[model samples]
Target: MTAGTANAQRFREFKMPDVGEGLTEAEILKWYVQPGDTVTDGQVVCEVETAKAAVELPIPYDGVVHELRFGEGVTVDVGTAIISVDTDPGAGPAGAPAAAAAPEQAAAAEEEDAEPQGRQAVLVGYGAAPSSTKRRARKPQPGVPAQPEPVKAQLQAELNGRPAAVPTPAPVAPAAVPTPAPAAPVPPAARPVGAGAAGRPLAKPPVRKLAKDLGIDLSTVAPTGPDGIITRADVHAAAAPAAAAPVAPAEVPVAVAPAAAEPGIVDTAARERRVPVKGVRKATAQAMVASAFTAPHVTEFITVDVTRTMKLVQELKQDPDMAGLRVNPLLLVAKAFLVALKRHPEVNAAWDEARQEIVYKDYVNLGIAAATPRGLIVPNIKDAGGKTLPQLAAELGDLVATAREGKTSPAAMTGGTVTITNVGVFGVDTGTPILNPGESAILAFGAVKLQPWVHKGKVKARQVTTLALSFDHRLIDGELGSKLLADIAAILERPKRLITWS
Candidate 1:
């Protein structure tokens, strides 16, 4: 049989998988493939931004692209189909089979416990599908006229990027009804773009929320986003003039009406700019809040002279054995901290609230806090306690570089036993840092500056810096915390303690 007459085309729907632990949804940043484009298994079709990080999603099956369920910048929930593929395109038209098998049916098939017959291995876990809830429909209010069919057609045309034909109304006899006054014409700038049948403007959920919170009508806000979608910036720009307008006195009667007070208009006193919290920033904020509230924190500070450590850093930079390695104060600081942790094994632990136990760790997964354009992320090196100084420095370099590039994986940010945040890079002296959730402690490395010191009973200039260690009060008390901090400081001051202690 010829390929065209073999069988009807079969379609497969690719659902949005849960890329990270407990991630509900992700926003499609961009689509690399379009409809009719051929795609292979494991080929990345789009990039999505989740609460934790930006991740690229790969299509699991080979086929010609049939449809994109959602557009760019649209947030889709896990287990929801994002794209469709024509799996058996050689059979020509999908015809009756594709029509018979609706998206709902495909979703229903995926709900089974065991994998479906043709199911392919997903890159990440396919999360549980969201439960469907049915709601009662509201009846139309009395005295409200039904919308015209032609106007509804026009709205749909606008959504599809098509020019709609103007419909001519039939003439009525003069005696049938009294003549009504002509309605005011809407300004072109004030007109909504790509409106739905219900007259609601096209915008993302976040943008809609921002407009709602700022008391701005989305219809009045010009859409600058792709496909005539209203953006956050557009909403803010619409509210700007109203926000800048001068307020009138309560006693004074004004003839001209304010821009705000008009029906279906934007009105707000929002002086400060509002940014929607999402992606990395949103996750960081939530984690910090949980850590602060759940874990009782106690911060301890100590100032130390690190002249010898600084000199050793310069010496290591020139050494052949440590050649091509990142030899900085942070490198030394991390090594010293690791050595201190080795001496105080009890400090490298986590408080398991669920188990109601203080779990001590045999090895450390040291997390390094790196600040990026997206937000702050802490990507730790696995089994940091077992690595050599050169290996540690290499890992640190890679981790920081990856984090700054916004390519750090969610896996790298988990299983951290201890953390070190280098506030010194920002010229900060010290800070009471919050512990990373699940980790017992976080050490803040302060700026190293030259100051007058009594070296061998003589007044001389020496390198000085301060260190702050914040720990879980429940697991580590003042005595244990102080000893841990003191050990780290001693290693830095002598620079020989690393050799002796190790």
Candidate 2:
């Protein structure tokens, strides 16, 4: 290729794309590439923590790494140029010259003077809005002299590049304007500490917001993050003691004393810890709150002998068809729920408030709630109702594994028609689980324990577990909800019913 042609193969700026679900910004958690690193299309170049989850972003084109505009831990707005890559790797020294010749001051001035290009980034739909450079008017002091006419005009232009009103100074006698004495330097502890205090405690915006929400003072929280930064764990550690202690009434104040300094007596603060809710935890909290209040929830529980289902799980595991797939009581339970949904599709509907309609779905998007390092996320298997037992087992296994890895995509999380949360995995007996937003029902499976139960008029030890089904009362009445739960219980009680019911 010609020298001019090679040099013209410019560096492509990869702006931070909105991963999905209307996320506006993300914090760069880590970068997998640096300057001069060769990167291919579809290579995961960096990991970012969005408001929803930590997502690894892949490069869309092959190139040689040029620059990373923002560093790790910095929250970058969507459509902002994050990394630049030289598309033509062959133009080595020529490319280096352009980057090296670009002086920092010149770049800064150019950026300041440049108008919004209205360039579209990855993930098309809408371009980022033009950022305004609006500034607040500086308050005038009593004796401070006004800037000269030319300087004042220049300052006005720089503020917003528009003509602005400049306050002219009033004539005053030199003797009338007395010089004020120098103020005393304030001590750090004595200085007024507002939310935005100078030399403020280092914390991410999400962590700061979490501390604010939990009524935990960040200044008191110890910093454990790098560079003496206050992390989410640190904030949560500080809030733990307060959360565990008896909450004082709104009108009353209670005095809390640290435990005595005796060898065995540990201070409450020392023993306690606070965790700031963000990413998956924060999303789960908001979703649950919205699901609880918005939908009139009605939960029904049933305890049944799931010995037959458990046996079937074992049988499936040994079967040639299911040999490689994960075979567990959860797999059977999921299959049973899908079968029940098939029997009573009414319970598989969602309420469309805007349209004032009960939208019934013919297909099932079976959501399995998986607990990951981030928090609880329910990623679903699309068209699960049509999947066979082996198919369901495979999908369930994959869904859980993906969720555990925190790699479940936004698409996998959305459009869940119904959900199943297995609290049994945690050894919990049962729980009234809130329905996933937009879904009509959610089933909670509890721990299976050997319990004495009357089997054909004789008290026999059987594998028994409780099932809780919570549904939106506005869409599903108690009778329909009970029948659906009963159907699931009956299937588990007799695994053969799954064959007969279908």
Candidate 3:
């Protein structure tokens, strides 16, 4: 038929999708499109934060945005319609058929507005239609006086003495409408621009939580995000001044200081703070606790002189092939681990309790443990067994960067066969790192220090470090564990087995 009729029939609704497997809900972090904006299929419409990670949702059909059902910061259940669109390409706001149907549409809109919105799972891109059953208005209870409709109606009846002759009294004057008196001025502390005076500050829940942990007031921190929202960087910047504030001199006076140093006495009320366990930290904690108790753990340690590995790192940094990549001892250690894994593939297997069997993976998804502001996350490099030295270094650098920025995807953190955690960066000599859940083993690399050791029967200073390998006793016996640890150490000590072994 006509374009107007076609436009009215082409409206569609897009429901939220399950971005990650088994995830029930996601909080809308930001909206990229508003009503009346043109959108295409596969265009990102909004960003949502799930329990595992933040993800962007793309629309599945081309359309002009008709309505946004929810606002940012709302935690919406999966499969709920968040937006509606008019899918007809040529549809405009001034379409004639829509205007002609205004009266019927208005009645329907009123009915819909009277009902409370409830979350119900619907197919993606399909929204539930408006309920056909209309609700009747509540009647006055017995013995209760009914409220007056309005003063204007009663006044107009009084002015017209005879009902038969009375015409609808002239419409009430606009100025005659009674309005409530102005509210009292709010206090300054309760009237901060971004928060108190208007409404809640424009910040995601995670950012707000971060500000709370850092003890930074969101109202005081200037927002730099789109639409004047507060972001993670803004909170960190607000906390910077407090962290950098200089401490008072010792000679100032013992009484003037904030508190005195004491031995074996901790003021838990003042010195301690508690943070809610949730998000990445909560998941990590639950997994660690379960893995530690379910699987019998056996840790083996070995001390080796890594002087040769350090020299190799320096040489690689200068080599033309690796000139632009990140060259460090971790690179060499990772390479050594990969070479060792090839020789002992048994170490790359997992104990499947449900199947009651050992599952050996042919490919290696090597996990690297990273400490981020959020918590500890292990994001793995997929198929790390097949990459060359430079390729491995590049992937390692990218993994570390993504983890530190809290941008690691859920897929990147799964399917790990083995893991490595470097405790060396924190200046620790050694640590017994727990195995990542679903993985067979984790290698902990400790601080490499220059120590006096006997070399060629002569005392000399050498770069030496201790490595701790923690594995599942259920699947890996002591012999297999010792062999894997010894292989890694040998590669690091000699720096030539990586070539020969590979």
Each model's TM-score? 0.68, 0.69, 0.64
Q: Write the per-residue lDDT of candidate 3 for residues 337-395, one digit (tens) a residue.
A: 98898988988898878879889889999999999876888989999999999999999
Off by over 4 Å in 1: 1-9, 97-271
Best by TM-score: 2
Residue-level lDDT of model 1, residues 1-502, one tens digit each, is: 3222333236788999999888998877778998899999999999898877778889988999976766665567899878889887786754322334654443222111233454431211112211154345455444343334687667545533447765655454365455544454443345445353235576555456556655788878877654355665677677656544543222333344456656774334332344567778898999999999999999999999999999999999998888888789999899999899999899988888788988999999999999998889898999988899899989999998888877788888889999999999999999999999999999999999999999999999999999999999999989999999999999999999999998
TM-score of 2: 0.69
Where is model 1 poorest over a 10-residue stretch in terms of lDDT? 121-130
Q: What lDDT does the true structure give each of the candidates?
A: 0.77, 0.75, 0.75
Total colliding residue pairs, candidate 3: 0
- Poorly placed runs, candidate 3 (over 4 Å): 1-11, 89-275
Writing each residue's lDDT as its tens digit, candidate 2 over 142-227 gives 66654457675556344322356565654554867774533443444553232122345545445566577556787888765533
Best by lDDT: 1
For candidate 2, the 10 contiguous residues with the lowest summed lDDT are 120-129
